[model samples]
Target: MILSCIKRVSCGRIRPVLTRFLRASTAKHHDLESYLQFLQTQANVATESTYYKGLLYEYTVQHALKKLIGISPLTRCGGTGDNGIDLMGSWNIQKAKKKLDSLTILVQCKASKTKTGARLFREMEGVHSYHVSKSRQEGRTLLIVAAPSAITKQGFAQFQTTDVPILYCQINRVQPIYDTKQDTFRIDNFEHYSVVQGLLANHAAQALLEKCDLSTAKINVLMKGNSVEHKKASPPVVQKITLT
Candidate 1:
């Protein structure tokens, strides 16, 4: 049955459906790009001072993680912080007829024009190690470096060699596109999409989603049990057509 369906789609019988799907997908992509552009503009205007820029970077990382993972992270902004940890959060996993499990995540945000190198990664690892040792909380830790520009090849290579896991989120600068007909400036490139996609595809994010599946299943079962019932009505008599 699946093969037959695939053949039908391949034969272009469902070309209209495919076209509609593509259009809808493109519309969604455009909408997301517009939203990212708005956020970028806000960040650019808000981060005037160096201190404010760092704060904004941390806040952006926190916001993005919460929005993408549905988990609110605790942000440590000013003052002497816990080593170098910027944001920390946990995911609660519920199981049927089993004890609940929790997974903790630690994030470090960097808003720099220069690419992050091995030294930065080592520092983060040291900080995280100290934090875990003191707190005695054993869980997965992820280093998230949110930069306005791209990470250098050397920096990325350093990241790959680091024992600690890290996630790099590079926000690409949007290029301005002038519309001659409309006499307006349009923005191109939305790097936030790729950043969000990377976070969503991370192993930690997958674990969180897997845990949520249990909750979703339970909710679905409850919804099915409490489903609304419609009253049955009498059928009308069918009108027979006379043959000519």
Candidate 2:
């Protein structure tokens, strides 16, 4: 069947393979409810573990950022004494001709089930500001609260007043999608919960990007690189599973 699918592809027979594959895959999963239940189990495990939960959330955010923005972030574990910043990285922004610019980014990750309020945002802003000043580097800082919860309206308003741009990734807002034509399953609303998108669209975030001297060409390059990485890093479908 796989070989036949390949042959069909070479002969421009895309519709049949897509339809058949999607049907088979969807049948195996049963329905969205089951998939969501599995996700909920995973979430429960992450939340129940005290030590591993924060690490898991930080690593997940790091991986997501790499997949979504094409920039690798450094994770600072708690035991190592992370002076308030959880992740830090730099983006190589390419300009006209052979010129290259670098934007230093600092990120703080929050893993909680409750809504993030103004208090947390204020603390994050203060910590990020102190780090930037102490390091003596003119860098753009952003706080990434990756919780499976909402942000208080007051908290969001408070964030806007801060110098550092605050972005959010609410896991609950992510929706799973099954694409029949491509025979693929993925989180369709990941971008909607992405801090990177917030940075690209929000006025304050845009100002920060501009302050870092990122040109339109550089921004385009960054986004294009991320798109390629996302395709390469997508999770593969399980062909079969056996229970003992």
Candidate 3:
């Protein structure tokens, strides 16, 4: 069955031989090439599938962020050896708690089918640690993990004591996150509102401030029901030196 699916050739004849050969359990290496090919093809398909899911969610998350924070498009960086970092962008504001323009927005999006748990963030944690270590030597950076699926209560608790923010936002349209009818991205969690609000303040100008205010207010209205007790997250070190 596997070989028939992988090859466009007729397996009607080889199917019987493959079945009989399998039942016999004979050690015939000459005919193993087809099986090896099947294995490699399956492996490749699986790899591509996983990468595609990650990339799709990364892009959707970046789009949602722009609509949420009134920022330009962010870079999608999810791929092999990406250090679990998915989206990278810059957040500009008049003034931030750490005296930076939200230097760089580093996002890791987990598109898991199951409820997001602490285990899902293991790789991203390493990425965050690397940045936190070098933050003092560089501008401020806001590292965020966005799990579109429901994050179990335990998942939220895991990051409560850490500096990284766990955003319970969806990355695709099927998540039923908010107004799934349209391609709109609304943040449904309020735990980190202050952190996000500070980024969206945009006090640099009256027009930008109002725009951000409106966006944030809209989000607040949409997420009020899901809002929970707030937690003051540790100050993130970030600056708007430049983001490529």
Candidate 4:
């Protein structure tokens, strides 16, 4: 029966030995490349894990680009009370002998750890355009949305939903690394969240700086959730700072 399908596919010729050999290898998971290629060609299978993995891959690529640009990536910057600006920083692009002035950015970190859609980007747009009114009037502004773990196809679609001029940052590949010597946990995908947040905030800061004819600027960090230490000897991870 299967042979008939192959015969029709291959112009009415059946190489029994070859057919048996291919099936045997496929059944044992030894032909992953072939299986994947088949899936690509057929376009019918929609596995959840495969979908998530693709999302992660796309986000990781964006994170890598932000890192190369010299943006001081951050995790979460804007607290619930603060406006939409979450993370802010600049890319110190090098020019002629001396380091060029940093290009400010504002980032919105999305750490939902699940698939996010256009509504998230649309919400950021609202915050950037109206709620956070300071950035827009200045002209040098950008709103960035970074999702490290998952970015659904719908979320990408949402990006076209607005003309708010926001940069999209998607981070995939979340791996936890424990450093016993340092007694600290560093997330490999931290840039994913921070870059998006930083780019958006940078836009606001840059505009303010340009208007003031200033070469440097800083951003305030706010958060809705409690700090890991919960206000003990150590301060909350979030704090205010002036960037130059």
- lDDT of each residue in 117-234, candidate 4, tens digit only: 7678778776765533453222444455655444456765565556555554444445434466865544343342232222222333344444434322212121212123334323
Once fitted onto the true fold, the runs of candidate 4 whose alpha carbons sit more than 4 angstroms away are: 1-66, 73-76, 95-102, 131-138, 173-175, 181-244
Cα error, candidate 4, residue 107 (Å): 1.3
Question: Which 10-residue window in model 1 sums to the lowest lDDT?
Answer: 1-10
lDDT tens digits, residue span 82-124, model 2: 5456655665545544322555555666776677678877886
Models, CA RMSD each: 22.3, 17.3, 19.1, 21.9
The local distance difference test score of each candidate is: 0.41, 0.47, 0.41, 0.40
Candidate that beats the other on TM-score, 1 or 2, i.e. the better one: 2
Number of clashing residue pairs in every model?
A: 0, 0, 5, 25
Model 2 global lDDT (CA atoms, 0 to 1): 0.47
Summarize candidate 1's per-residue lDDT along 2-33 as a digit string, tens digits.
Answer: 11111121112311111111111222222333
Evaluate residue 53 in candidate 1 and report its C-alpha lDDT on the 0 to 100 scale: 59
Per-model TM values vs. the true structure: 0.48, 0.54, 0.48, 0.41
lDDT of 1: 0.41
Give candidate 4's TM-score: 0.41
Candidate 2 lowest-lDDT run of ten: 2-11
In model 1, residue pairs whose N, Cα or C atoms come closer than 3 Å (at least 3 residues apart or on different chains), thus clashing, are none
